[model samples]
Target: MSETAMNAARMIDMLPDSDQHLAYELIKKLVLAWDPDFTKLTPEEAKLLNEAENDEFVDAEDIDWSQIGA
Candidate 1:
């Protein structure tokens, strides 16, 4: 990350936990405004997502949903 971005993150980290969400929302808006089509993921995010894609799991159709509300 760029020095300015790192600095911004450090500043955000110093905020109280209750205010951190506000900081996050502001950053998200700015990022979206700068690139509305943004969909790129970080290398670590991509790696984790790729691993999840290959994980074994049950199919949705096989789930016993009737037991959920009971």
Candidate 2:
């Protein structure tokens, strides 16, 4: 994989499962804004790309998973 693709994979692994969908949405928006020529990504890859794209530098403990169920 290219460095960009590898980095994206790592980012996806770091996200909480609950945030995966949101992550994918964010990635798609970014890809659309930045490069329309970006290859079409599978839903799974899109989710991972999104997570990586939006990943904020923070401790995982900062989020409250209990509140996510609402």
Candidate 3:
């Protein structure tokens, strides 16, 4: 890892639990905004990509567990 990344990780680690969570969320937003990969896609590909992203519809607590131990 780069020194800059290491420094950032250290700073993140020093945050209190709630602040750490907020920092993580801020980082996620930054990463999404920093990439332009989606902008280069053809229109049709973009539509399909968006549909697949939307298709990941599971909620954390709503998962089916009927076959978990089978």
Candidate 4:
């Protein structure tokens, strides 16, 4: 991430929970303005996706969904 973006994120983290939504909305608007398609992934999301790629694959037929929360 750029230094400016890191600073912006730090400032947002300092805001109260209620005000965080405002910050998020502002950033979201800016992102949409730049890329109307909304095809971009935030750095954090990309990191999570990279991590998930290294995880073991699970087969749908090998598991039962009903047993998940039982």
Top candidate on lDDT is: 4
Candidate 4 has a TM-score of 0.53
Give the alpha carbon lDDT tens digit for every residue of 1-70 in model 2.
6789789878887999868778888888988987788777877899999999899776779988789878
TM-score of each: 0.52, 0.39, 0.49, 0.53
Candidate 3: give the clashing pairs. none
Report lDDT (CA) for all predictions: 0.88, 0.83, 0.82, 0.91
Ranking by lDDT: 4, 1, 2, 3
Clashes of each: 0, 0, 0, 0
Off by over 4 Å in 3: 36-70
Q: Compose the digit string of candidate 4's lDDT tens values, residues 1-70.
A: 8899899999999999989999999999999899899777888889999999989989899999989989
Judged by lDDT relative to the true structure, which candidate is superior, 2 or 4? 4
Candidate 1 — worst ten consecutive residues by lDDT sum?
A: 35-44
How close to the true structure is residue 18 of candidate 2, measured as C-alpha lDDT?
69
Report the backbone clash tally of model 1.
Answer: 0
Q: Output the lDDT of residue 65, model 3.
A: 85
